[model samples]
Target chain A: MLKNFADKPLVIGVTALNAIDSPGPGVAVIRALRDGFGDNIRVIGLSYESLEPGVYLHDLVDKTYQIPYPSAGAHALVDRLQYIHGIEHLDVIIPNFDAELYNFIKVSAQLRIMGIHTFLPTHEQLDARDKMNLSKFGEKYKLHVPEAITIYKADELRKAADELDYPLVVKGKYYEAFVCQTLEQAHKAFYQLSAKWGTPIIVQKFMKGTEINIAALGDGEGDCISIIPMRKLYITDKGKAWAGITIEDADLLDLARQFTKATNWRGGFELEIMRDADGKLFIMEVNPRFPAWIYLTAGAGQNQPEALVKLAMGEKVEAFSEYQVGKMFIRYAWDHITDVSEFQQLSAFGEL
Target chain B: MKLKKNIATSENGFIFNPSTGDSFSSNGIAAEILGLMKLGRSADDIKQHILNTYDVEPSQLDRDWEDWSMQLKDANLTEL
Candidate 1:
């Protein structure tokens, strides 16, 4: 470590590099960080799979390390992280995967001992937005949420199906959803998704309406740093936004601020919203981390991830007051051809 | 088993089936298997070749082959 430096470079670790059909926010977050700090920061890419392209993007990620999958449990994760920290000496880690956030939060204190910082919502704040607790959260915070219930068993789905009208959504606890208009479709989707993502699937009232999304950042002290709302212009089969345009809506901003104030939420969050025919916004799901569309925040003016870094560093950052609306983002696939030996190396050695 | 005809596959592992108009991406090994399948290699031949080329044991390779074949069947890229 350098003794007397006016400004030492910041080394930040980021996860969630899977940007395929079901996108993750790591690429977007890294882009936002690059936009903010440029050459002043070194990005340490943390990946679960060997093929996450972010690991190979030399311009974006300064270094990459393959970490144990979250299913490997906390001990293995911490060991790998400890080894990586010994080498890279990260100043902060921004975990972008929903499955991995809990593990990061658990080890945050250990990380702090190593001089690494992370700004994240408390465990209670995270629990409040869970699929099982969505209704409770909305009820407690005076927000509108569609009727939903988590089914612990397949038989429970039948009961939920009887209550929620036909064409209701059968959703896994974490990911995957299907709209079932009949008992047969409901049962099939329930069984299939349960096999994939596990039990306790959510049976939600499927509202026929426009889907809107808000990506916002909240300080731990009941203050929202930035809020950017977008409406999907084009959606793929995976339900991801291929093209979206930012919109200026005070009501949406107010909802974000109110929610953050209610939960005292810290860090980046994306609120999945459904707007009905009457223009009423209902919160569908509250993602605890930044959304895959988070890069749009950087383009619009407020680099939320950069602000999050400052907050994590214990530096005070003022809330962003202005943004350029109507800015659009259209996602595309770009292919990078590497040698077969490169693939062999990464798969065999666990690093690129 | 045979790979679907008119399936456009690139070296970078992007696969586009012109018939079904469905596109998918494969990993390096999957791409190699698909390429070999496109060349009309039999499953046993490909399995033997992989066994010789990679360090995986036969039983593990067999299991992986079965799973990969199932995935290819699900994707409608293979006809058995």
Candidate 2:
């Protein structure tokens, strides 16, 4: 059982504080955590870059510390967390970046031994949902997924494109995807994406449909605690949702339940789904963490982050049955002005 | 020949299809037609109501009625 936080607030550490054009879930997750716990939680911002907006958002984050990149390996990551835990006595740590989750999950046991708890998916669950293995996962679970061909060289793009046919999607192993209507466009995307995200470019069959997303949380025992389905009203050039509304769709909710049951998912996750003209649902991508729009789950009355914290603390949480439908979230940007001294303090001392 | 059972419409011409999570805004006439449909009115009754309320000719209403029904079908708002 977890200790009562009546005297001292629950100090939670969060990573991926970047709230740029392609926003990270950190800032939004922090907002949801505040909404959930009220004044009973203290947020410690774990940042990778000095310019991450959450570092300077003193209202949201009590203090900020710069963590090493994931390439520095799990040992370096655990060392930094140990230092942070020594000061903040972090009760829970939520790593929000796709690139950083592997390192975090790798060191979760060690962190637990040091008194910092985390609710994250197991390594096998993470590996199964990886983009490279999504097709196999879909096949094993009988889910509809777009066919994809993973290739290592640029010359292989033509063959993969031919197999999938024209108007395919060229995607990097990790990020960046472009829809190519011709072989020339495919070749160009191949070179650009491979140069940036490295080898094993994925050529997926373009499945045209209306896009829908679901933000869900599972209780690590194959039980879905909360599920909120949303449809994008407006999209940005980068394909991120600018405006979205909570929707009432049983099928979407059932899909999330099926995923949680199959994977026994233990944490927050996002499902990028596509509904075809005939109303067939296709699982396009499975994000292993909370989406940037996760704050909507709290607005819709689920408070998933709070539930996740409870689960991490070994508390039993009941599954949330209903959420307010038509609750909409419209994202807007405001320039957060801060002096260079704050940046210098964080950059020079690695803490602010 | 009626709107879906769970489809909700507001007085301000907003339509919400709960089944598909698609929302749409309609003009005054279209909203009136949807309101009538929500009341379990048949197609003929909807047309008659439109004729009684608006100053549209029967031939023009017939032409536009087909187009309007097609629009509802395309939007997946109607249970045909």
- The TM-scores, one per candidate, come to 0.79, 0.97
Best by TM-score: 2
lDDT tens digits, residue span A1-352, model 1: 3212137678999998887777889999999999998888889989888888787777888878889988888888888988988988888899998878888888888888988899998888889999889998899888999999888777777788778888899888788888888888988999998898888889999987777889999998899999988888788886788988777667888999999999999999999988887779999999999999999999999999999998898888999998877678999888877678866776887766
Worst 10 residues of 2 chain A by lDDT: A1-10
Q: Chain A TM-scores, one per candidate?
A: 0.96, 0.98
Which clashing pairs does model 2 show? Answer: none
lDDT of 2: 0.91
**B-chain TM-scores per prediction:** 0.92, 0.93
Report the number of the highest-lDDT candidate: 2
How many pairs of residues collide in each model? 0, 0
**DockQ, per-model, please?**
0.01, 0.61
Candidate 1, overall lDDT? 0.86
